[model samples]
Target: MSRSPCLLLLCLSLALPCMADEAKPGHMVYLRAVDPGIVQDIRYASAHNFTGHPLDGYQAPECLLSVDAAKALARVQTALNAEGYGLKVFDCYRPVRAVADMGRFANEPGDPLKTEFYPRVDKQDFWRLGYVARVSNHSRGNTVDLTLTGPDALPADTWTPSAHPVDCTAPYGQRWHDGALDMGTGFDCFDERAHTDSALINATAKANRQRLNGAMEKEGFSGYSAEWWHFTYSANTQKPDVMDFPITPLAP
Candidate 1:
């Protein structure tokens, strides 16, 4: 006996995986698809990032990560939600092309976003300063740059070409408003103050960093000391090394 079309469709739904599990290249999934509770501010997808221009290979502002990593992140979000705090990711699952774009920008002659992103440092020295790496772990799909947010977090601002750029290391209230708790400095701030354990920040910033680090650690995410917002979930499902998949938008 042949099955009806609708029945066949229902059977397929049960037999195959959901869009979240298959929309991405091998084992990768959008973080929001897994946990919408976590906020996302993918600056590299827009002019709001240090690159000034949108980075290459970022077709959309979506946070993509390895399956194991996304599940670990979701667990962290659940834990933070209970405490009235949430995770806000800035970058995830970057493409290798985007990393190359960063290197090209670093070697170029212009510094349009200098005031806001790397004020005190020169762009040419980004590699030496350890701000821009020739090979980024983000391409591996398990690393993420994120911040913590709570009820009192500042409101994120709308960025435009005409918007004035503020120093990333400027005091919390004076810097670009990203609706994140003051973690010493803004996300991607190349200044020493952005260091996870920098002593220059006030008591509040220190406490917030500690809290965010502790929460991520509890979920098995390793925090990068040089960048307060950087974390990596060690158990990656995809293992061919750096990925080149473009971050495409979810089906509307």
Candidate 2:
């Protein structure tokens, strides 16, 4: 027998929410499409990251962010550009599987890039120390990891699998040259010195950090205390869910 009209309506209503949930992360767009001026140095797509290898699902070295976040970041870039500074992104729109891969890397024994990325910290303590999150906001499509670039910043060096590692917490010029202004430490430094308000850093580093923080904060991004490069776009009204879609290459 056919179902009653009321029952049919209830069933249809129940399915609607599930159908709506599937449409999330669809708003994700290439950051360059919005602002090519925002330099990208996506580490997770290469072997330069803490893992010493490209993370899973990062098929391309591109930055992806929600539409709102991208536009807001573009505004920040424009503001900074007027001051002779621009944003250099390290990572963006991380996939859910990449987060899982990071967890697994921390749980395992090897630490090939330990000397540079986490010399003072143990891999197993990454999650407990707040250096790495099992569920990153980047998977939600609004968080970004970036730094500032200016005239004084050194040119970015080409990273290869065989390059020797340097201490990430060392002084600005002593660390790897990532074509970014001094922000106390290098990207992905898992030490306390990488903290946004760490006292160990010199005055120059502190000033740069404050400058970057102020710029990003003005654009609706909030910096994570543990890592200065980390920021989440809070101005967006859309509530995005975690996504595992592969990071694919953008069209040329």
Candidate 3:
């Protein structure tokens, strides 16, 4: 029952596209596929995160977001590029397993990254203080953690845990340099200084935060009050369902 060579070639061509479409479901799309201009740091996929180790379910350092959210983010990228600024995403479409892992790490009775990420907050109080949660808006795929970066944004600074650790409350430049615009505090800084409208930050940091908020808001995304870098798209047709899919690289 072998098909002719021409027939087999036609069948293969028809099936390839379908297989590729099935590979990545319609709900979640790799952000780079939708908008290559967006920068991605994807901290959970690397040891540079608060856990001091890579989190679960991050098979690749890629940003995955719900289809609608991805489209909205692409629009935001377009708007920011015009202003000579760019968006650098730290996290997007977090997995349920990763959120659960965060809970476990928070309760594991250790503070390996405390000085870098949560200087003022105790690990045991992470859930109580609204830092880590059993469920996350990120799991729903509409939320994103991001910051602004200019053409001259710096790269992440080298850190050695054995050295006297710098407090998360340290001045932006003095602490970890994430190559992003000085937004008062580094990402995952569990302190009042990371608040979206914190008055203690310098003028430049305040302006940078405001600019980020404004740009995100213009694209119909709302900022979280506690974490200035957090935002969720609000124009979605339906409420997002929590997802636990592992983030893997998309097929070429």
Candidate 4:
């Protein structure tokens, strides 16, 4: 696919300010179109977000892609659709600013209690645990936070599969914590219990998580050991500085 030279220049200019022509550690950049298999679909999970609500300067849903990574994602979507499952993307190709926002939140004096999510540890522990790393793969446009939904929803449509708003504060099952029947925890749950193969939860939830893992692995994506919903496209898996660029889809 031919890339928009204007968009590319715009991306470079916006992401790499005049002060620094080169892409910095915390800057956003475009993904080269190496892979078309990676699919793009927004709206799989609840409108709920990690920052506890929508924040200023947020944009609508779109999939960003690294050339090869896009192909892998597209293939993954195709396979899932064949099985009557669809992808609901939370965030992809994040800009470095967004990552900074996360870090800033963690440093804040008042982060919400983690007992409901990271019950074993306090909210401050995230800083100590290194889960929220300074650099994330997402900025490279190769990593994504996602969830599975039924295929009835078209590739461009959004749907809430779990039926309720994503309650990050409630217990696992009631708040979307389990992995088996699909009502487990939200995708970005920052807890040890959200491990890809954790047994602290019920069997049903474990099975559900396993299903997600299986699907991701089949399409060249690997589940984060500490996160069930986090996946990295093997095609272009370089951990880059975090970015917060708005997702811009390739024009059809």
Q: Candidate 2 clashing pairs?
A: none
Model 3 Cα lDDT, one tens digit per residue, 1-252: 233344334335543211111234577888999999998888898877789878877889999988888999999889889989989999998876687689779878777777788877788888888889867889788999999998656786654545456666687667778788889888888999999999988998899998899989988899988999999999887876666667888778
Order of candidate numbers by TM-score, starting with the best: 2, 1, 3, 4
Model 1 per-residue lDDT tens digits across residues 1-252: 233344335335544221221135767889988998898989899988888889977889999998889999999888989999999999999876677689889988888889998899998789988889766789778899999999888898888999999998888899889999888889888889998889899999999999899988988789887899999986544443666667889877
Q: Regarding lDDT, does 3 or 4 come out ahead?
A: 3
Reference-based TM-score of each model? 0.88, 0.89, 0.86, 0.65
Candidate 2: stretches off by over 4 Å: 1-25
Q: Name the better of 1 and 3 by TM-score.
A: 1
Judge candidate 1 at residue 105 and give its lDDT: 90
Q: Where is model 4 more than 4 Å wrong at Cα?
A: 1-47, 53-57, 112-120, 151-173, 176-183, 237-252
Instruction: Locate the minimum summed-lDDT window of 10 residues in model 2.
Output: 15-24
State the C-alpha lDDT per candidate: 0.83, 0.85, 0.81, 0.54
- Candidate 2 lDDT over residue span 1-252, tens digit each: 233344335335543211111223558899999999999999999989899989977889999999999999999999999999999999999876677689779888899899999999988898889877756788888999999999999888888778889999888777899999988899999999998999999998899999999999998999999998999999977767767677888878
On lDDT, the stronger of 1 and 3 is 1
Give the candidate number with the greatest lDDT.
2
lDDT of 3: 0.81
**Tens digits of per-residue lDDT for model 4, 59-173:** 5455565656666666777787687665656666655545555666677766443433454555566767756754567766678777766532223223242344444435544
With a 3 Å backbone cut-off (N, CA, C), the pairs that clash in candidate 3 are none
| Candidate 4 TM-score to native | 0.65
Question: Per lDDT, what order, best first?
Answer: 2, 1, 3, 4
